[model samples]
Every structure is written in C-alpha cells, then in structure tokens.
Target: MKWRVESSNMKQLAAVLVCLLAACLADKPQPCTSPPLLTGAFTVSTQNEELWQYAQFIYDALGQKIRMKDLGTYDNQSFTHDVLLLFREGVMYEINDLNRTCKKLPLKADFHPLAIPKDAVLLGQVVIGSSSGPGQGLLVNTWTGDIGGTYMMTVTEFGCIPVTTVQHTNKFGWIMTSFFNNIIGITDPSKLNPPDFCPDAMTEDVTREPADFWSLFFNK
Candidate 1:
C-alpha cells in the first residue's frame, strides 16, 4: 500500500513539472530575423510632415549588401529613388527617378539586419484585432531598445513580421512613427539590382551618413 501511494505522489509531481515547463516555453520571447527580400508599404509621420511609400528591400547578411527602392510622396512632393548600399564595396548609390540621375557616395554605415536586437527588452504582448473568432486577431510582440536612437518595434508573434516602429532621437529633436503593411516576399530578384544608369552616375563629395527612409523624406 505504501509503495502504491508513493508511486501516485511521484506521478502527480511529474505532471505538475510538465505543466510548469509548458508554461515557461509559451511565455519565452522568440526573436526572429526577417526574410532576405521583401516588398511592403509604409507611412511615416512626424510633427509636421508625413510620407507614404512602397518599398522593395533586399538584405543579404552573408554578402553584407543592402538595397532599397522607395517610391513615395513626402509633404506633398512626389519622389522616387533607390538606395544601393554596397557595404563590401564601401560605396552607396542614390538613384533619383525624378531627375534620372544617380549619385555615388561613400558608405557610412554597415548593414543592420531587420531583426529584433539581441538586447531589446520585451515591452509587452498583445492582440492587434478582435480575438472573438478564428483568424480574427493578430498576436504581436512589442520590443523597445536603442539603435542610434530610442525606438519601439512591434512585430507579429508568429512570423516576426514588422507592423510598426516608432523612433525618437533627442539629438535630432524629432520623433517619427511608421506603420508597415501589405508585407510580402520579394517576387523578382532583379529588382534588387542597381539601376543600369548607376554605372555612369556622378560621384558626389558629400560625407554624410546614409539616411533612413524617414530621414530621407524629413530632410527634404
């Protein structure tokens, strides 16, 4: 009888341990990297400025290459451009479609992958939409950290797909919020290639760091 009681107690303890392990796994943060190529649309807004654009981005970590094409309107001005950041070559190409020109300049920064920083602190987890029914809501994770500036990023819990990012820089005295939507994998690899006209483009003597999507419009 004592042997049976002891065995039953051991089984109960094992069941409780299993439940605790499952709970811990469920709450663990899962940081993820984005796809190598993606196309998406985003809107960035600041105090008195707003920019909307469609973006095709390529991120090659192994080769240390990054390219982005942005066609958009900024503060009522329409602009189309491509920023080819070749880290290995130490050169960046800013191709403007409006004037059909490209400016080659020095690459100021290295490639930073589109993933949650390793030191990012988990802010919270929430549901984006209605959770009453199946396929109704998106579970997302919010993370906050400093990367050149203080920023908060929200991404889907399942795929780590970006939903929004808010960045603030005290040095620049600006706070920008961006919303991303309709994100999908890149359909054509050729779209990542530098424009044909870039070979004969002029080399500019500017020594400024490359601008991000929001800064590009904000500075204009």
Candidate 2:
C-alpha cells in the first residue's frame, strides 16, 4: 500500500511539474502603453490617417483575452476590430496603433495587431493555450472548436471600396487539435447596406478628412 501511494504521488508530482513547464513556455500576449480600453466615449491613435476617434464600453477589468463586445465595434458600415490585442496571452503587449475595428466578422488567427505596418510597433503580445489536455500537439482542435480561437483583421483597399478580410484559426494547427476553422470575409464598398440601416454609419470612406485624423492620432 505504501509503495502504491508513493507511486501515485510521484506521478501527480510529475504531471504538475510538466504543466508548470508548459505554462512557462506558452504565454499570453499583451500590449504596452495602450490607452486603457476605452468605453462609452474614447479616442485612439492610428497610422492609417483615416480613422481618428473611437470608444469602448470601459466597463470592467478584463482577462488576458477580451471579446468583441467589450473591445469591438460592429457598426452598420465598418467591420469590427479589436480595441487592442496582446501578441500572445501574457508576454508581449501590442499597442493599438491602428485604432481599427473588426472586419464585420471573425477572422480565425493566433495573434493580434495582425500586421503592424512598422517594426517600431515594437510592442508584442503573448498567446497562450490550455495546458489541461494531453500534449498531443498544438492547434489540434483549431478547426473543430475543441479549442477556442485567435482573431485578426486584414483590410485591403481594392479601389474606392475597401475589402476587409478576416481569418480565424486555433492557436495550434488543426493537426494538433480538433478540426475547426472560422475564417470569413466582408467588403463594404458604399454599395451594400442592409435594409433599414443608417447609410453613413456603414461605409468605410477613408477620405482625406478621416485619413488626416488617423495621421495626427497615430504619429503623435
């Protein structure tokens, strides 16, 4: 009985040690010097020189991860983007230099601040996953919803109209986790507006006025 108990305890100790190691290895991402997530009424900085002012709920203290509702804006015109995102889950913190919103939908991804135009956006984020499962691999259930998601927004101006692309995937590739994928796209060219919605609120017009606004906020 004594030997059996000792063996079980040893196994538990080993498991605990392994978990701690992984937790150390895989961390969460964050941003540095970001304006505390704004709510109600907030202003943000951006490099694009189009989007200038913005706001967030600014309601409660959040965790390493923040949802769209808390840090997203799904306007009748523009797609939603993050108020901010951590490079990972806990390590590098990304500054919201873009001050952008989502792409009207989710784009499966692993990290945040998707594409910082400049390396000077030195700040980064740490992305962490669950350490509870067997160490089969990383991003296994990414496609199957076994694990949650990491989101990002990519915008391309195809002309007067802008094409917004969103691709979301698990932290680990599908080979590691389940088979789950959430990659979607949306484009608002001042043409398509849902019936009964405000027209101006929905279009992404990056004209000189808005562009200038973004420049002042981000460069400053």
Candidate 3:
C-alpha cells in the first residue's frame, strides 16, 4: 500500500511538471500593441508629374476589413472623375471629368486593393539596395485585376496601400498613401446628384456624325 501511494504521488508530480514546462514554452514575448490599421480619410497620389492626380479616400472602420471609397480628379479637370470606385464593388457612376456630365455603368469587378492575386509572385522582402523605402517588407508582383499591367508592391502591417510600389503599366498608376485623417464614414457619390445620362441603364454614345457623302461623290 505504501509503495502504491508513492507511485501515484510521483505520477501526479510528473504531470504537474509537464504542464509547467509547456506553459513556459508557450509564453513567448510579444509586441506591446498590434500594428496600426488604416481607419479614416486618407489622400493618395502619384509620383509621376505628368500623371499627377489627387484622390480623397475614406475608410469605414466598422467592419472586419475597412471599406474604402475613392474620389479622384485630374490635374486640369474642372470636375472630379466621372467614375468613383468603391473597392470590390462595381462602378458607382461615370461623370465627365471635364464638364461634370454624368452617366452610369454596370461594370463590376472583384478588385480589392489588398487582395493577393492568385498568380502573384512573392519575391521575398524589400532590400536596402532596391529603390524602395527603408525597412524589410514582403514584395509581391502581380498581373491581375485592375492593375491593367504588371505591378510590384511592398506590403507592410502599417497600412493597406503599398509602402512602396512600381506599376509597369500606366493603366493604373502608382499610388502612395500620403495623409491620414480619422473620419466616421465617406458619403456615397451616387447619392450626391441624379445621374445626367441614364440612371437605370448604362449607355455609350456610339453615334457618329453624318458622313460628307457629297464631298465623297465630288472627289470620286
């Protein structure tokens, strides 16, 4: 009986030691706070002088992923771009960048600015030798979605937009996260005014002016 009791106590001691060892191993040191997440109004701009444009973007912080709304205007345009993108959502509307004439389009695409394309090639971390900003980062190159051309982006935990970027094509110009301002939400562009063109259907002005048949007849 004495021997059996000793064995039981030894087994209990062994179990306790195992648990303590596991706890010590799992309790690794961690950073004090999580990395900063973009939540509010921010400005995005391009580095190329001739391709300069300003975009005012607002972020909705109430969801798992912050929702984004972008309002863009060109350098010399009197009015904002007719099209404003709501991230993965379709075209909210198309307005004439020059005259403010507006139309709507059914064009929808699954374009998340932070989404990693299926074919994206992870090219390792950013190095000081590269023209990218300081600090090591995850470098990824992709040729999908609205990128319109191949793009290389350096992602960091600090912000959704690339810390550094290079777009091989001008279709979607390079964007830099310039400013941050906390805001509740962004107003929907569609709600601002009634569409000038077709509100219910997307339209394209394919009409051509009447050809000069008289001139052709005289020349031929």
Candidate 4:
C-alpha cells in the first residue's frame, strides 16, 4: 500500500511538470522575420457559409522581391494566376510570365499591398499563440467599409514571419480571413534572379510639358 501511494504521487508530479513546460514554450515569442516560402489557403465567410481562397507566396528577402499566386472565386466562377513583383535599386518591376513582359513603374515609397494601410491606427500588443507554436501578435485598427462597422485585425507572427491574420468587425460577418501553412526555407537560388529582358517604362502623362519636367526636377 505504501509503495502504491508513492508511485501515484510521482505520476502526479510528472504530469504537473509537463504542463508547466508546455506553458513556458507557448509563451515564447516567434521570430519577426518572414519565411522564404509560404503556402496557404484563405477563406471568406458569409451567411455562415465559407469559400476557399488561394494564396501562395515566395519571398526573396535578399533581392527585395516577391512572387505570388492568387486565386479566388467570384460570381460562382474560379480564377487563378501568378505575378512577380521586384523592387530593386529604387525601381519597381511587375513581371508577366505568360506574356513575357515586364512593366517598370514609379516606386512609391513604402508601398505594399499587404501593408497596414497608412490611415489605419495602431493598437496595443497582443498574443495569439496556439498549441502548435507562439503567434506573437499585433492588434491594429481597421474598418468594414461596406457595412459601416468597427473592425479589428490581429497580425500573428512566427519568429518574425507573419503567419496568420484574423480580422473582425462589428455588424460585419467574416469578410476576410487568412492564415499560413507549409512554410519552408527557400533553397533554389534561381527564384531570386531577375528576368533577363529589359522592361519598358510605364507611360507618362502626355499633358506634362517640358517646363513641367524642369519644374519637377528643380523641386526635387
């Protein structure tokens, strides 16, 4: 009887230790850097029903470029495609693989589609970690324009890489939702290389006069 009681107490202590270890691991912060390759599915929900949206991304941090494929369904039809965007040496290029073309456009400072809009407000820090890993999270201000509701977004991270984002708005259903999975480091160097062909410059305003150009230059 004494031996059995001692063994039972030992088991309980072991279980307690395991729980503590897990709690500690869960609280650890993920890295702020992004993974090289991340593939994932997004979903849009309305009337309690959900539809799958597609997104696959490859990041070339060293080259400051990104390649992505985005697919979504509209009007009961589906569409799919890929696009490569390069930002190098104060220039931006939009590459079209199927047409074998590239478009050089003016580089708007700090312009990124996924970046938090300049008008949005920044909220306090947050933690969205789950069982799989820590999701050091960011809470920010947002809005549901169509429904005229209050919106909030939580950008979740995994070791510096943003792996998931959860958005919510009062009076608005699940309008947008996205998360990442199958993240892997990039191994192929070719994915970072720029296209060999030269791209044409974006069309300029035809109405601008020579004097206007001089004025712009002098102002800069």
Which candidate number maximizes TM-score?
1
Descending-TM-score candidate ranking: 1, 4, 3, 2
| Residue lDDT tens for model 4, 1-220 | 9999999999999999999999998765422334445434444443333334566666665566666566665445575545454556534454567777765545433323343333445454444533455545443222222213444444444334343444443323454555556455665556555467635556343332222211211122
Model 4 misses residue 112 by how many Å? 6.5
Best of the two (2, 4) by lDDT: 4
Model 1, 1-220: lDDT tens per residue? 9999999999999999999999999788766776655556555554444455666566565566766776776668887767877778778788776777777777656566678888899999999888899999989999999987888888888877778877776434445544465455556656456677776544765646545634433443
Ranking by lDDT: 1, 4, 3, 2
* Alpha-carbon local distance difference test for all models: 0.70, 0.28, 0.41, 0.48
- Against the hidden reference, what TM-scores do the models get? 0.75, 0.19, 0.39, 0.44
lDDT of 4 at 4: 100
Off by over 4 Å in 3: 1-49, 59-79, 86-91, 95-102, 108-110, 122-148, 158-161, 170-198, 205-220
lDDT of 3: 0.41
Instruction: Decide which is better by TM-score, 3 or 4.
Output: 4
- Position 34, candidate 1: lDDT: 66
- C-alpha positional error of residue 56 in candidate 2 after TM-score superposition, expressed in Å: 21
> Is candidate 2 or 3 superior in lDDT?
3
The superposed Cα distance between candidate 3 and the true structure at residue 183, in angstroms, equals 7.9
Candidate 1 — which residues are off by over 4 angstroms? 1-8, 11-15, 48-63, 71-80, 97-100, 171-174, 177-179, 200-206, 210-220
**Considering only N, C-alpha and C atoms within 3 Å, which residue pairs clash in candidate 3?**
82-95
Model 1 TM-score (2 dp): 0.75
